[model samples]
Target: MTLRKPPIPRLLLNNVSCMRNAQQILRHVNVSVHDGGALVLKGTNGSGKTTFLRMLAGFTRPSAGEILWNGHNITESGVFHQYKLHLNWLSLKDAIKEKFTVLDNVQWFEILEGKQGKSMAAIELMGLGRLAKEKARMLSMGQRKRLQLARLLAIDRPIWLLDEPSVALDDEGVKLLEYIIKEHRKKGGIVIVATHLPIEMEDPMVVRLPPRFPRRMTLVDMLDRSGLD
Candidate 1:
């Protein structure tokens, strides 16, 4: 009898493009990542960073192109839902209930996902154990961001999709986020982050989106505005 190695996880985007209301957001974007890898998305405002991330999360459909997971097309209806089970998407919104306490929010997530006793460990890891009982409404912006990030630890998903994850995080909070990402990658997990803040990662693959075209101006108008004398 011979032992075999486990298959490596992979994600690929083939000439992906997205359109919203007839306006192209992303154009012919392509990227690929394997397990234990990280991909960072860099783009200017309106350059479709969020839109592309949403498409990867299956929350939005791409106007063109295909998203593949482990060599399988994820855009297919049945495949998408199944693939989503292994993904964790943290959007710009905090997604915490104002009325719930810090620990309560995480506990609720665990309960809803049928995961018991998995909340406290994650809360503590995110440095929220001290504020466990504090209502989310009372926590500071940085604290709230940490609370939101704790979900990643609690959920145990292999793929993490974060948009502007460091929005309100302070220096320490940013460090915590980095630590979490590093550990996740070490465990053969995949991470994709859309951020403007600097993140410390080892050999991260970058996808830079070009700036969107100015809709209100024509070629002649752009030249006239160039101030060439």
Candidate 2:
């Protein structure tokens, strides 16, 4: 399929300000991501990477600011088809259906999304070929991570929002993720990852959120758990 112009500045945040529990989280932050660009969010926990991502995904409302997509404000549609058309997301939990087999889960996703392809090929690409028939509940943590990665390849979205994609991944899984990211960038896809892991990418932009006062343990430990230490 021929790709569109990518709508320069695929995602734009204008004077974004967010707060939680009466505490200001983000302060008039403005950022833009162009086609084929990469943006990495790095901060100790409570830095609001997840909250920022949620706002981008339209799951949470920002206290102030506008989110624009392809020159249009996203507040109207509330992150629907127009936004989903070119977006895909992956978090650390691996959220693969535990009751389904690897191949079955992939097949189900394809069916639900009205997308189809060579399932075995996709699994093999993620090095999960041998576990194709294994149920998600039966797979190892690393294997589950591969399953999540496989979703990226199968869906082929232009914009990827990944929250800690490397969690639970082994050495080989990390290598596979690197390869996948490289290929995605080559294909003109945009990636926004909220992680502190040392990823192998080409000059990816990094955004570090300010530290929250009171030295919250939950706020500091999540970033450390991201494996960048």
Candidate 3:
């Protein structure tokens, strides 16, 4: 009997740029990540950290350049859908159902459509086991954040896109998040985190975006500026 090695996944952003309301948000940004690697996106508010993740998630298209998932263009016909199968996204918004129990939220048999894995690891890792049967709405803000992150382990996806994952988490929760990331990376999974707060990752590739400021105006510029036709 022969065993086959797993495929090495790659995510590439070639000279990507994003625009909003006729203004540039991200300019000619480039990124590349493969199996077992991590990318940390750090920036101030409105600096486009979330925009970068959204672009990778296929929620929005880039204004220019290409997004390649395992050498296939994500925007190509039928590619985004396939790429989605590998994504485990943690957005700013929690996906918890207020009425669902904590354990049930991560183990939603009907609402979630995919292979369901054991949710106990995530429940124990996030310290939510004690509240397993409690309704999600009864949990506090930090608990909600932890519950939202528990989705990362529910499906065993290869790629994780975390947006501001540390927002409502405390020191212990943050540490647990890092530990989970390390274990995932060690298992050949890729992670991409967009956050204002610093996170600990093993030799992570960092992308820093600075706040965009409006073009400066001067008397000579005002005189030379052209009027709209």
Candidate 3: list runs displaced more than 4 Å.
1-9, 109-111, 214-229
Q: Residue-wise lDDT of candidate 3 within 58-109, one digit each (tens)? A: 8889999999998889998699889998898998888789998998988883
Please write out the lDDT profile of model 2 over residues 1-229, one tens digit for every residue.
Answer: 9877645587888999999777788899888888888988887877788887887877888899888888777777655558867778887666689989999877776676788885677899999899898878999888888888887788778989899888788888899998899889888899889886777889788888887767457845987888665
Best by TM-score: 1
Candidate 2 lands at a TM-score of 0.86
Whichever of 1 and 2 has more lDDT, that candidate is 1
How many Å off is the CA of 164 in candidate 2? 0.6
| Runs off by more than 4 Å, candidate 2 | 1-7, 215-229
Whole-model Cα lDDT of every candidate shown, in order:
0.88, 0.83, 0.86
Worst lDDT run of 10 residues, candidate 2, spans 211-220
Q: How badly does each model clash, as a count of residue pairs? A: 0, 0, 0
Q: Is candidate 1 or candidate 2 better by TM-score?
A: 1
The whole-model C-alpha lDDT of candidate 1 against the native structure comes to 0.88
